[model samples]
Target: MGTVEETLKCPVCQDFFTDPVSLSCGHDFCLTCIQAVWETEGSDEVPFFCPECQIFLPSDVTLEINTNLQTKAHALLHQQRSALREHTVVEVTGDPLSLKCQEHRDELKLFCMEEMVPVCCLCVLVGMHKNHKVFQLHEACVDFKTSAADFKERISDKYSRIRVVLDGDERLMMQIIDAEEMYMTEWLEAQRGHMEAQIKEIDSLRASRKSLLQEEIELRFLQQIKAQNLWNPLDLTPIQEVDKDLCDLEKLTTVERLVDDLSVALSQHFPRMWSHLSSPALDSKSAHPKLEISQDRKQVYWRTQPVSEALSPQPYDSQYSVLAQESFTTGRHYWEVIVQEKPYWLVGVTTGPVDKRDALSQSSSSLGVHNTSWCIYHGYGQYLACHDTQEKQLSVGKRVRKLGILANLQKGELSFYNADTMTLLHSFCVQCTEPIYPMLNPCIDASGLNTQPLTMFWIKDHWDWHINTEGAKE
Candidate 1:
């Protein structure tokens, strides 16, 4: 080959970019290629500018010639392109064979922890594998096989359990979504009603105000016309010199001001109408339900189940205290048992306390107390009833006494019966998640005489009331 001048030149140097320096930008060219620009007047740094873009480089510049790039450049410069390429390939393949220690050379073996490949013993104490978690080549494979089985079984079981939970969550998620959509519809309806009511009020006010103003304007104009007509040239005595000019100006100014005020009021108050119409307000909870995996990867529960009238009642409810005790105390409170059920369920006074009036001691006005605790049913509502005991003589109005609140309808309904006469009380519909409070007949005075106080609840087909000390165990 002819003497290769190009071979002596750096490819990055091309003409003068030899002894090339590489910038952070990955552009490689001779030092001279970028040095001048970096040293330009007003330039704060030298040998620190990107050659291609003239973008300034940081002060902590590193311009080392990349060995791989230099090699490639040199190969390009040489006339033997194919041979150079082949030489590069051989360089990549030819890692020098590591020598084995004399002691292990004859039967040398090694284990690669990373690759899990067995190597000659010499490779073990050499590059890369020296600090690796390795065992003797023969022992490593056996250990791996043992551990792999255990891990496989464990992982499989975990994933299987996860799949089961995932299936449950998927089903529950659909219900949750449906519940949320229903809740949103209800909430939106409520909000729309409220807003429309306000809108109607505002429109009424506007109409009334406009009508009054228009009447005033018309009256003023009429007065002005009357004044102008009085000055008809043919009229006799100038009619007290009707000043139409003054009348016209006064009416015009009043009408203009009134219109302006109404316009401003409308703009200020009704500005949000379009926005509300376009993007309605979301319920307290977003309609969207999010599904996420638990940190421990356990069962899934809803973050929010959405609020619907059918599912949840307002929080600070006082109706739950229908048959609250006069004085709450242990063993002294009254128990209202619904004897109609097989379980003979009852929840009554557990604490000794009473809401009081003056001049009355616990004997006169004892109130019933409850544990305030309840049983929660998954996918259903909880059931509870206040204990009405002799400790407190709670009274109900005639109407309330005739009607008893029903609750936990999903499990069963609550109906009250006169413990004495066993009379049937009226049954009431129980909304979801709401506890029923049965308004009671007047407290039986200490004499055990039943008074005709307003009592709620009528007789169901067959129900009885009984007090068993054994069942009263707290």
Candidate 2:
């Protein structure tokens, strides 16, 4: 009885009853807890009892009675007991039968997904773990520990890369702003100088016209006086007549020339002044100002793209090392093979004038767009100039759809791509130091509507070598 008081709790009503009842089976529990469960079944005398053990009661014994054991159990509950509560305090919170492990007395940390109970790892392995889902705390902790370190490293690296990109963007913006300010200042000064010069020229023209007008008026006045004196029958004073005519002529010429010069100056200056002042607004649409810095940090061609109109491509025949050049004779027709090793081709097309230029540059302008002509599709695996051909400005007929493979034995890498799309289609490692001779076959159809591409070959040192395509075995 003392052992039962220390360990077991009722499954139905949870509390340790004053009187403990023993069923027909060996199981025992509080009498009140079983009675309460019986009442819930709505029977005057329950056909079954010991709800905890589910044992049947005797049909002949139906009376409810009190026993001396009830008084003794009640006195034991109020007495000083063990640290692990000896008396059960009835609770309605959750499952009443659930209890800590009897072996270690430890709260279970593992969850049995099947039975929906917390258990220790040992209990799961012996009972709940067979053909059922179980979660162990130690396993979860180990998995999280491994993932946490990797995530932290990734986040740290990402932030560092973002900072570098932001710094570069800030530098570019500052350069653009500075270049625009300088360009505006220079333009404004030039406009002011031109306007001032025009104004000075207008003033000079007015002075010249004024002098000519005065001279004409003086001569006419003198001629009028001379004719009047000559026709007079009565004698007249020459000085008084000349003085009166001269005064009237001076007044008329002054008013007439002043009005004419003022009108001319206003008409000329109005349009010029307005144009000079409004030039800033018009200048906004002009090319974006740029700054070019030399190796020594000195200003070079400011507010200009690095590319120049006079720029020409250097010939590849001189710059690159030729791997093989073989010529064959087929009677009248000459068959030839020329293989050259170079950095992977930056293939493009252009449609502009191509009278005198390298074959590559001519192809690009006729086919490629600006900025899209410098893509490295294979070796470097960049997609820079991929979209240039799609632009409407680039002529459609001058399309470049030829790919060049670059196999660098020194670097142990092979890079190849689609020439038209500038997409990196292949990249792998090479083992052999010797150069690989890629096969060449001329396109059968060369109709202008769907022009055939030129076959390119790379022969390594005159040997009949073929690309070993055995999963990078070579």
Estimate, for each residue in 194-251, the C-alpha lDDT of model 2 and write its tens digit.
6677667667756754655575577775675475463456342222122344224443
Instruction: Report lDDT (CA) for all predictions.
Output: 0.38, 0.39
RMSD to truth, every model: 36.7, 33.2
lDDT of 2 at 270: 40
lDDT of 1 by residue, 1-474 (tens): 323445344343455225567777766666665565566644563436564677777887866755555555455544345554533222311112322333344333556777565556555566445666667755886888889998999999998997897577567655665666677667667766766776676677567546544655777766755654633543222113334553344443554575577558755754221121111111111111221222422211122323345522322122111232222111111123222211111222112222322212333123223232121100112233333321222232221111112232454433343343434442222232323222211211111111112211223342211223235433
Cα error, residue 103 of model 1, in Å, equals: 36
Candidate 2 TM-score to native: 0.22
The most accurate candidate by TM-score is 2
Model 2, backbone clash pairs (residues 3+ apart or across chains), number: 12
Off by over 4 Å in 1: 1-19, 40-47, 80-474
